[model samples]
Target: MNNIKSVFSINDLENLSGIKAHTIRMWEKRYTIFSPNRNTNNVRFYTTNDLKKILTIAFLNNFGYKISKIAKLSETEIISLAQKIYSDKTDSNFAISKFKLSMFNFDAKLFHETYDKLLETKDFEIIFYEVFIPLLDEIGFLWQTETLTPIHEHFISSLIRQKLFAEIEQAQKNANFSSNEVYVLFLPMGEIHEIGIILVNYLLLKKNKQVVYLGENVPMENLTTVVHHFNKVNFVSYFTVQPEEENLNTYLDTFHQNILVNSPHKLLVLGKQVHNFTSFIPSIQCFTSIKQMLNTI
Candidate 1:
């Protein structure tokens, strides 16, 4: 709790707030929204307070609140209005800001609070797609830009995983796997992203389909033993940065021959790598999104 970053650069602000650095500078010049503390070298940087205020403003701005009017309000008024907007739950931007702050500060309680607040007006699936997906997408770019450390990613990811587990557990209490085809969820070898797969698992369970979650970085050879357990099954996988573009088709061919040949089983593919898929096999299916896959299956 005490070890989170105390300072951020303009680029960091741009990335986190979704406001360009020039706009931030213009806001400062025109409205004097928040003062940035300059370092010894006279470079512009922002304190954690500046970040919180920007997120608050951005939350409202995205929801139709004007910056000109926002600049006219007192800090207390701004916070109070934000709270009212939250209570109304008309937009996910407020929740997204809270989630981002939780990730940056490594605050589990804040994450849970935000999730609970969203749950009051939204179902788990709505919250996942609306708030969580955008937050996760931003964090991915933030990590790639070196604006956030892996530790930051892991901390927030663990909190989200906890919620997913809780949701999945609650759904499982009334387990009904009456579907004819069993679903096996996994990620390809060398792929470590598990959040998408877990979300899919939750949805599949919601559909009353039996699911065998093999998890991330699963090798092709290791799946034979599991597939033999079900008479007819669908292998669901998310391909996020595991099989390189050049090797993706080869990987698919290997899976088709090794696992799906002359069998009633099929493979369902999801994730970013599916965009490169030019041709299709009879048994292998690629979906553009989780919702599409859910609807199709």
Candidate 2:
């Protein structure tokens, strides 16, 4: 038998649910909704169940459910109501709510079921371009608004990474390496966000292109070495945060001077920072979207 006594401190709740500590305390005092336990020292602590309850409540509140009505529901009833709300076909709002619920509950089964249902009716491209991308955009907004925390982001991102990896593996089996142009995928130094880069790699491999993925935080000097070896190379990277806004011009100038200007190959850059180089970007080739980049190659 497993112990059900694992306690989560108020900090844990804040970290897991993105709800402010003061706000959670106010809710506790103002309403009889959340009742956390006290340790031997009389310090309050929450449970996994409490985290789930708060997540459900937050989701409902975001969707315009009155806090008064939400506080009246029992735990079981709350879960059931969340499921009903998630299943309604109104819009992407419901899907986003369901995805958040899955993250809060750590319910991989629910995540997979919801994703598979969407996949069944829509093609993978539609699912990626329409559903997954929009969901991620919403997640970004929630994070910025402090409506979701790092824990919530990591929980859902890991699941999405798993799905991407599975698709990549399947694509690799059929990928053709006979071509001379090998695409090298990487993220610049100090940049660790690889989800977008990984998805691009998956798409390239799916299209039967040879891809060499150096992953995150790759040094520019090391990339120069790769350029030397591959006779026909197209280097790709996602520049989310490596180069600060002020230094973006310098970074692009150095890249153009050192790599793209002289080399016979091309360098494809994406992400928000790339917008800084719009004027100076060489007509050789630059892409803003994955679909456009893929089409070019």
Candidate 3:
């Protein structure tokens, strides 16, 4: 809990709040809004309280309130105005701020409320691209910078996975695939990142394609067994932290020999590792991002 409430540098605030450090400094000096503490080296930092205050102010500012006007309002008044703003309507930026605030405090209510509010106006696809994607990208940066904890990461990710699963189930009920093409989605063995694959499943369902979701860390042989049974199999995998960087090429070779050789199956791969490979064997397509894969799908 203490880790979750830890302090953040000015740069972190800038990253998390989408406010420039220079602007934050100017507001601090002119409006006396946030009283951040300074370290022994005179480097300034802010507490969780300061972060929440800035998020609230940023939220209000998005609703057409001027910085000067926001600085003049008391914290209580700021909260009041923010609540009103939130109740009426919100955009992507406001939704991101609310999501960040919820993640920081582990406040499920705020997270659900923000998501529910977005659902009132937008569909699942709109929310995923506009809200969840940006929020996840920010969360990744926060994790990289040590501003957020594993607990925080898991909390938000689990909630999102739940929503994705619900949406996927709902979409799958009415799938209308004309072709017998089956998409077999999974992460490579030793790779555990399934969010990319999960999103792929959702998109494939939206395309009304048959999806055989094998999910995370599936073995190459298991994939082969599954593909052997299907006449038109499109094996998709997200290569996040697997296929050992030193042996990525070797892993691809093994995958090709075992899965694609003498078979009509096409392998579609994505993630950080996929970028490192300069070339791929025949029938193997490497995608840099989900959007690129979406085009092919």
Candidate 4:
């Protein structure tokens, strides 16, 4: 019980719901939607339940339901309405809301259940781009604002990583590796964000391409082993951080000089940090997304 986060500020509510703090306060005064409690410091705080209810309300309101109408419905009715949207239209918004609810409540069951439901109607790639990516993007903002803790972030990331691994395993069974260009995936040294690269591995494997997933904070020199082994290779990475903007050009120069200067191998990259890159030779390419990389290779 001590590990549970039981309360949230209005700012937390805003960050999670994508609703304005002013709008939430207006909803409170105009309707009986919230009854926030005061802490010892007299700061207004809401329960986990309040956050859930607000998320549901926001979900419903987004689909043309008026707040005045939503205010009159019972909690069950509101949730039923939200559920009906996903049921009838297969709305991604409701799934995103359900995921956020699961994260807040630490409900692994709900997370899996929601994911399984999505799988019934959508392919893994669609679900990933539509549901998971947007949720992760919002989660990043929420964490930056202190609306969520590391515990919450880790809980959801672990769940998603589990799914990625499961899917990657399935892809591995069908991998032919007949393509001459063997792909090598890794994160830069001093970098630890690996979800993107793991997904890239699964994507390549799904296409029957060969991939060697070195994974998470790999030094540049480590590539010599694969370089020595595979005659044709495409070294892939997703740079969320590490290789700071100031160091990006220098890092690219070093990698090109050492890894691809005279060799036939190439480097393919995807991530926000690559926008910091200045210039690169034809052998070194940076992608804005996994989709773009797929289209190219």
Best by lDDT: 4
| Candidate 3 global lDDT | 0.84
Can you tell me which runs of candidate 3 are displaced by over 4 Å? 37-45, 62-64, 83-89, 276-278
Model 3 TM-score is 0.89
Worst 10 residues of 2 by lDDT: 1-10
Per-model C-alpha RMSD: 2.2, 5.7, 2.5, 1.7
Q: What C-alpha lDDT, on a 0 to 100 scale, does residue 235 get in candidate 1?
A: 96
What is the lDDT of every predicted structure here?
A: 0.88, 0.75, 0.84, 0.89
lDDT of 3 by residue, 19-88 (tens): 8999999998998998889999999999888998888887787678998898877899998888777767
Greater-lDDT candidate between 1 and 4: 4
lDDT per residue as tens, model 2, 1-297: 322224577866665456688988988998877788898999998766686677678777777887689888888888788777766643354455567668656688988987886665666666677767777776777667564567767778888888888888888987777588899998988997778889999999887889998999887777778877888788888877777778877876777788777567777888877754563565235567888788887
Q: Of the candidates numbered 1 and 3, which has the greater TM-score value?
A: 1
Model 2 ranges with Cα > 4 A deviation: 1-93, 279-285
Relative to the unseen true structure, what is the C-alpha lDDT of residue 142 in candidate 3, on a scale of 0 to 100?
Answer: 83
Tens digit of per-residue lDDT, candidate 4, span 43-73? 8899988999998998888899999999999
Residue runs of model 4 more than 4 Å from their true location after superposition: 1-4
TM-score of each: 0.94, 0.70, 0.89, 0.96
